[model samples]
Target chain A: MTSSTPASAWSRDDTGITVTVSGAWITSRLDQVGWPKAERSDIAGQVVVVDFQKIETLDSNGALVLHRWIEQLRKSAATVELRHPPAFYERITDAYAQSRTGATSPPTGRWGDSLAEIGHRAIDLAKATLHLLSFQGQIAVKLAQTLVRPRQLRAKSVVHHMQAAGVSALPIVGLLSFLLGVVTAYQGADQLARFGAQIFTVNVVGIGVLREMGALITAIVVAGRSASAFAAQIGTMKINEEIDAMRVIGLDPITVLVIPRVLALCLMFPFMVIFADALGILGGAIMATLALDISFGQFLRQFQTGVPILHFWVGLSKAPLFAMAIAAIGCQQGLMVGQDAASVGIRTTAAVVQAIFFVIVIDAGMSIFVSILGV
Target chain B: MPFIEQNFAEPKPEMMPAVRVRGLRTQFGAQVIHDNLDLTINRGEVFGLVGGSGTGKSVLVRTIIGLLRPAAGQIEVFGQNTQANSAAAQALRRQWGIMFQDGALFSSLTVSENIDVPLKEHTRLRAADRRAIIALKLQLAGLDPSAGAKYPAELSGGMRKRAGLARALALDPKIVFLDEPTAGLDPIGAAHFDQLVLDLQAALGLTVVMITHDLDSLYTACNRIGVILKKQLIAGTIAEISARPDPWINDYFNGPRGRAAAFAGAA
Candidate 1:
């Protein structure tokens, strides 16, 4: 690769043309540096000299160049002589000579170095992983320092994340949770109709949406929204060295950066869950009122009596825990970023994956604990 | 008591040598950066440690500030062993500040917010007081008042360095660690940085441990010079080292670039 480039890059004085491989249409070497056609032409009227010396390597280009010149020279009744060629080039000519006599030799340049390129890439990735670890330490120190010393909150940033995690999320969470409630109510109304127990549909839909599905749906929505938000935000900061700067100034990025976002999510998630639950329950009530022919007052009364406060608080408690898990995973992944753009991508992937994994595992455990303890 | 009597009889402890690093050694895997390095920087002195890339000059300064842990050796800051995780070691470090090669200013934070960070974290100053302090420090560092609202990315390279300097001296730190403070600057910018360092040192009464390869920086600012080579710090006064024939020093100072810097300074 190295040698072949310089060969074609320079021009011979007599021939005044660059040499590159063409005939073989593969990795073929040039055998020798024949005198540039002029010297030989001067020596013998029919003599032609082609400089294979500059043709260290050739593809179709060298072959075409040779073919064109040789064809022209042959028409002129000139004989071509080869000069000093590399050993590899001699092997090529010898094989061509043998092949002309029906001799056997394998071909060159059939996807060569593909496996080597793959291996080289794998080794680079592994080395990069090790290099990334040092950067993690630098980031961790920055986090620690930022923590030891607290700084003013970025009102703009906090508001931005707040709007994304809470304000913007309202429609989606509202749509899904509310629709789930309506479906619950519709199904309940259908079941109760057989026994003339249609009014009980209000209690069923209300309790179900508010207690279990409301919180569950809210959490799932947040796992996708806020968790990923944390990952992208922290990851961007990591790539840009904002986290490191935070440390130099003795500000704990985690306590300052992560804590605020986590805290915001913690406070907002449960409220969002409640808000989503209210919307969902209202949706269920609407479905019930329409299907069961139950009035709003009747539906409200049934719902208030059926679902206990314990159910409400149980789901709300998990919001902060989910917030903690998301923050920890996202910030940890961000701090793990290296000195390159790829590290941010890798860490962001890790953040989302880890956040979702922990949220599920912890949520399941919490649900069980709450149920077992009769909360 | 008279001012002279008070100054002489009970000299400030900073003047008694603020940062003393002795027999410092650190390594990353098989590569030993600093070994058996000893350095003592007096208060109000701009001590320059110069060496080529990978010569451990930066490593030595980082080791002093407790950024990179030393594999072997003792670092005493304000007469306390800084390597230990004791309260005293941490307190000693609080008296020092560092400016990294790239300025290392918080891109997300505005200039005033960046400078106000140290005060907000360490002291119990009111927000107004902190703002006042930040403004004063910014003024002292030769940065404009309006720059406080600008982020690191928004500022010029020279402005970034100045803002970083303001952050470093925000708490009136006695010892300032500078790692390639003037690196990546144009000639005029670099000269301006060197003069700013001199002005800062004089105004703040700071002891600076600067890791730099800029020959002009060494001449303009440093009181004592040190070279980190072959995993050891060779320290001497500027004149003392000029008289010596150390290969690294010869190559650095007597080399073409070094001689050119000297000639420029002379002119």
Candidate 2:
């Protein structure tokens, strides 16, 4: 085969055929002969082999044609051999295969499709905002109903929700927290002991636990667990038309459903934080006893000395704020739940993600404020 | 031909009507039911409304009691225009009661608690007085007094309906609208229910505007019958409706079921 517009290729067979791969004016020399790829080794046999002896340099398209030809030979029962294509041919072939599998797919114009989608999305968003605005009056009425009917958001109900979310979850929280403290203490003691500071592991563990990390961890766990609870409960109620029933009967669904939950969570979080802190400290004491050979009494003495009373207060302060934000975000998404029950699961998931995200953001801010205060 | 030469039970029009609906028009969407419909409900009267489904008999009574607002009409309760947004309109509403098809019983509250709701809302009665009144209404509705402590969920369909009725009468409403009050009941159950309605109407002097598909209810309980068809009312007794050759009227009163009613009356 030679590089020609009306191209050709030659086979060793007596009744041979010459095939050309041509596109526009420009064509490569290898186009005159179809490239060889994979084929069967013997006539009327299916054992595969590749023959590239008749073909030239393996540019990607040439290699592709060669592959096709070889595949055809392999499908039929025919013996084949390849002199192994030129280096350029192998390189182009490898590049093409890598691209086909890799992050870069042959451009099917997804980038253009994506841009068009974004434009359509922008228009849809604008329409939705306008639609939601018309419901502003309804929102105000709902809010008023929620606030005025304290019976709906009764203090009794808050206690019930808190008991389920906070009290019932106590066992898992306790187990996880005790292990976390033990791990922290063991790791921290080893590092501190290198500098003759094994006793300061009390300070290290105490400072970390009573400060942001302990509270942050607890909040994240509860945010994932409790916040989603609020969203799912309320979202399910909304879908069932139970919320509408409340409204028709002159009751405030939000106060009855949401306020109690938020209040309960706010009341519950600080206690959970305190419990977690205690468990974590106890865990550290166990680690300290085993690793540093420190007696429990001595560990207590070190802890008392290192972790000031003020640190406990600082840690305790973050719990209520964290709980409030988590519960608020959860209830908000729940109230925003759509008619479909599937949206209940979706909103609950969103609530958890959003609550944890805000917890981290707020934790960062808390750290800065605490540093400035020098507690 | 006069359809009512033989109305066994006739309305004495000399007495004051408890409700007077004039030119009532209730429109939802493009359709108008109660289009220029007029009806007068007399004191101590069980007024039966018979209609093909969706002819707006429900809408007519709903508009009169202000449960639904009529598009254009004068609903005068005790001679006061109910559409007027004055204290009188609400006062007129307070004078009458309505029982919806769904029971509309507050599901969250217990039966006793549900009965107490309207009393608590409107009356200055003390808790003890409210309890006594609620108990009386329960007994009057033929509900078991023991069932009072149970929530709506625990109660059967028949019990919920009775409990709902107890609540409707809690405020001592002078007029009561019962829409298909005996629906979904056996023959004997429906008969006892009809008797209960007649008793309540007599006892309370209530002018009952009852919308029912039950031909038996129309024959037995109603002092005056109004047929709603083609968005207009053909007002008279059952026999009056029977003789009217208006195809829809004939279909209602001279058709197979109508003939059976006439046969039963003769027997």
Candidate 3:
């Protein structure tokens, strides 16, 4: 098919330049022959002829390209005429002819557009934050109501969420905290070995893992995992009009959907933190025994004596706060999802990022408060 | 000239039907949907396939389009076997377009860009030329040119269906398959859509296969009707099929809604 087409060419004549095109001008063949161009300078003021007599095949794409070329020539002040065209040429050209003459160019991005966009985004963010805060207030009121009548809680849904957000998360959180403990103990042993104080590794691992790493690691993992999951699942339900149906059926989405998941995370998070702390300390002991030649009995004695019980309480207390922020942001983002599929993805991403950001911010604030009080 | 004339020209005995399905069998696991179904859609004719819900109307269309492999069958389009994985089958795909139910336009793209997708894939037309074609297609589909810039999510149901039609006709395909184009539309909108389908079919000389439950659509748009029953297809002209004594056909054509549509179509 490619070999059959003579390349479309133009010839000069006394009548004008006759742009002769031959062989299949169909879409597949057009790629090889390409759009035929006549020299604009030569035909600008002259009558140019588009001879379509020898054309073997012409589809809409071909006709469109021809019509576009003819329009371009006419725009250049050339009197463009079809010469020796077959009967079908008119039919094909007219079928694909553009009714809208002007191709409107997209608006160019001006410098002020960026500023305006930023302003718009800022307003949207502010509105979203206010909406989230009000939603939190609604959750608090609902929580109080549910407390008064505990039967209002959907126990099955709460159990399901506990399994998903808590049980399913155990392995990854445990693995990461254990690895964190091992690294902390190894690093502490290296530093203390220089001064023949390698026995201090137990105190370093116990203090670091119990006070900071355990709660922070568990919170970060849950924020990344459950936050995105919550946003996506609820956003899909919103898209499917399930939320609207729930409203019509007199079931509050906050009570039926959001609260159970949030409640489950709140109940489960402190346990996760405690579990992480135990595994982290165990990892530290193993690393100390292997690297510093410290006996398990000696490491336990040092940890019991050197690490304060207050450190465990400090970490465990932060768990519920972190869980609240993460679950709230996830559910809020899910409820905020727009009508389109792309918005679900955007909301899910926002849920994860904002949850992590808030968790870290809260941790920092708590750290400052703890430091000021010399905890 | 031959390419355009071939569409309107009477089919000689030597010419191939646009689509031919013979002894087709489709099953999902142990449950059979269609058994020994035979259907032939001639060139330049609007063929409507009607069946009750879950009667494998969609499954038949999907099997014919090679989206779902049939349990056993021979399906041919323009004399080329559709089941083959050869280059000819690839080229044959460009000869037809399928418009799914719900005007399944890409949610991310504007309507014009959705139309441009096929042109971009199948043709080497420049951006300017493709844009010109998109505007023309939008006009042909009974849409305003301004609608080209709006995304699918922005359009109403009727306009979205029109946009889907525009995209389907982007390459000027010889055959078009519409899956319930008029389903979920208001009476006026459905009538308008049927007229648009007829006008485009006449203008482009398309061989259209529409899977529709809309009796009004069958009455007005289709030249031939095929009813799927008892895992087999019974095909004939609308008048001929309506004449059958089968209880299902009798119920379908003589039902109150069907009678109203038939009367409306006649008037």
Candidate 4:
């Protein structure tokens, strides 16, 4: 990497300051020779002569550095002159210099820009909410119309989405529900042991898993997986103009794309909740038997007698609302994707966040409604 | 001193072409696109490459730029072997630029930021200098100065192509490879683009390898033309190659649209 290039240096002579630049001044070697910085005192009221006579090579980057350094010296009120430079230095730098005449530089970020961005985001959020509400109304109308003409439902696509959103989701849903059940039972048994009533842990596990944990955990997992998938798939299709193609061919994209996914999630969600309940109760029974000194038979008996059937229905009842919200948010974000690769990623993240947020909010509302009815 | 100085800006008067390909083979799996293809693009000339769809026009460009490895044979740019791992070969890379079809600009960056990308990476110039050069490049590509602030998605189709050209010219590359430079522009827009390429080539003394389907671009801009057929390249000047008895070449050059473009070029 070593070369016999002279280091660029400056010295004061009787005439003025002569800065000699030597070596290959191309981009690959510019850092080695380095640019000369002028102090105001050194060149105050003196003409600075930059001698480029000994420069071995020059490229665009080298010329730019020289041009900029000279501009800086002239700005400091020192006269700078170049001596015996290669013909290409002026040729390259002059082209860029000419472009500075009419060009507006990029805007720097300001406090006003930040405030405007916040205002824009607030408006975007309001618009998105309105869009989602309108989309939901459209879905409701389409669903009602499809119910009247069942053959228009695209049964094959619905079945495909069911298998995709439900059948493949079994292992994850089952495993997470079982773990939730175990944690609930173990924690309950420990707390109950302090009151000398460890056997009542069965009631805690049964009531908790059957009423809330089963539905909430399954919905969260599905929202994370299926919702993001739906957003990304539809977003890519929208970017490729496949959605436009379908519309031009007289096929309603809402009927063809949205209904099947929403219907699949709505129909399959209850079955997923029921499967989660059984596994969750099974996990609770195992934990009770091992930790609370209750036999599996005793745990089941307590779970059946202590937890009412209404509590199981209370959890199962929330599944359709959660599923619809998740699916709707996912589809809405997909439809909203702008024309870029970055927006697909942005919308997929928004789909998961909105779906999970709405799920929790809806669950809280449902809990209040059920409590008001004394269910 | 001249021999040892190694000045890239002033390429010495030499017989070497800007790009040289010898016995190059390219393939995807069992499907061979170019087999033992040889090409030579002279320095300081506008070279147009035309071929039927699925021919290896883009593939050859990719191989020459070291994006795709050649299955066999060699590629050289400015007399340096492209496949070499030497420091000199690495330095040789900065000498050329490529513009893909459809103006593949970075979706996140503004057009000026896009042009600034290579300069920022390869040079230590101050920020103001880089911005000045970005404005220069945008002007050279025949774009308005205000266009530098807009993202690629916001630009019109012709503007996007010009932006892509501006980015390619950012580093003042000696050789530029342009893939389908006028594929989607209107007729007038495409003609304006052809003139822009010719003007830039003349002003910068660039060796331009353009892959195009526009007969107007071929007639108006190119100093020579290369046609890919049956996995081989047939290359010569417009008059020389059009005189060949090849059926596709004859159909391509003497076709109605081709004749109209040729008449326009003559006018």
Per DockQ, the best of the predicted structures is 3
Error of 1 at A72 (Å): 99
Model 3 agreement with the true structure over A250-353: per-residue lDDT tens digits: 99999999899899999999999999999999999999888779999999999889989999988888998999999989999999887778999999999999
Which lDDT tens digits does candidate 1 get at residues A148-204? 664554456666667777778889999999899889888888888999998788778
Evaluation by DockQ, superior candidate among 2 and 3: 3
**Cα shift from native, residue B72, model 3 (Å):** 1.2
- Choose the strongest candidate by TM-score: 3
TM-score of 4: 0.89
Tell the DockQ for candidate 1: 0.01
lDDT string, candidate 2, A1-375, tens digits: 132332233333442222332321111222234233323342345333343443432323334445444546656554444444456445434443443332322236655898899999999889755643443344446546656875545767877988987898777777778888998898998898799888888888888888856687789888888889888888888867799999999876755776677678878888899998888888889888888888899999987887898888888899978987787778777887875555777889988998898898888898799999876
Between prediction 1 and prediction 2, which has the larger TM-score?
Answer: 1
| Each candidate: chain B TM-score | 0.90, 0.89, 0.94, 0.93
Off by over 4 Å in 3: A1-21, A33-37, A49-51, A76-78, A83-98, A101-105, B1-14
Sorted on lDDT, best first, the list reads 3, 4, 2, 1
Fnat across every predicted model, in order: 0.00, 0.00, 0.49, 0.45
Per-residue lDDT over B66-112 for candidate 2, one digit per residue giving the tens place of the 0 to 100 score: 77888887777777777789876765666677877656787667888
Query: Which regions of candidate 4 deviate over 4 angstroms?
Result: A1-25, A30-33, A37-61, A73-94, A105-121, A290-292, B1-15
Query: Residue-wise lDDT of candidate 4 within A1-375, one digit each (tens)?
Result: 334443578898798888888886665555565555656777777888888988876666667667777787776545788899777787667676666777654567877888898999999989988998999999999999899999889999999999999989989999999989999999998889999998889889889998999999999999999999999999999988899999999999999999999999999999999999999988888888776789998887887788989999999999999999999999988988888889999999999999999999999999999999988
Candidate closer to the true structure by lDDT (higher is better), 2 or 3: 3
Q: Candidate 1 falls in which docking quality class?
A: incorrect
